[model samples]
Target: MITSMREHKGHLYPGGISNKRIGVYELPDADISKYQRPWRAA
Candidate 1:
């Protein structure tokens, strides 16, 4: 029974696993434009 169990365990497939790298970037503050509008007279 022990030998049969070992053989069955060996036949089992491995689970999915990945070793990928990810990159993140941030924009500079000076490059951003300001959104300002003049006030209209009432």
Candidate 2:
């Protein structure tokens, strides 16, 4: 779910579920476009 959220920037915003449940696991502010590998696309 974390990967998927990061993929599309779908629903993983500040108030999203991941933030609610996993309070310590914040996503990094990465440049999604810089990822070249398929698995690292997001």
Candidate 3:
């Protein structure tokens, strides 16, 4: 997902499912464009 962040250039939200007995949690939205690293050679 990090690889796609550069192209998104917008807000990013987090979400995931938990086991039956567990509850879900909400995460703060991130403007991750500034945090994206430049593409590098492998």
lDDT of each: 0.29, 0.41, 0.39
- lDDT tens digits by residue: candidate 1, 1-42: 112111121132222234233223333443323424433557
Q: What is the overall TM-score of model 2 with all chains considered together?
A: 0.20
Collision pairs in model 2: none
- Estimated TM-score per prediction? 0.19, 0.20, 0.20
Candidate 2, superposed: residue stretches over 4 Å from native: 1-30, 40-42
- The residue-by-residue lDDT of candidate 3 on 1-42, one tens digit each, is 122212233434333343233222333464565766865658
In model 2, what is the error at residue 12, expressed in angstroms?
5.1
- Candidate 3, run of 10 with poorest lDDT: 1-10
Q: Model 3 compared with the native: what TM-score?
A: 0.20
lDDT of 1: 0.29
Q: Count the backbone clashes (under 3 Å) in each candidate.
A: 0, 0, 0
Best by TM-score: 2
Which wins on TM-score, candidate 1 or candidate 3?
Answer: 3
| Clashing residue pairs, backbone N/CA/C < 3 A, model 1 | none
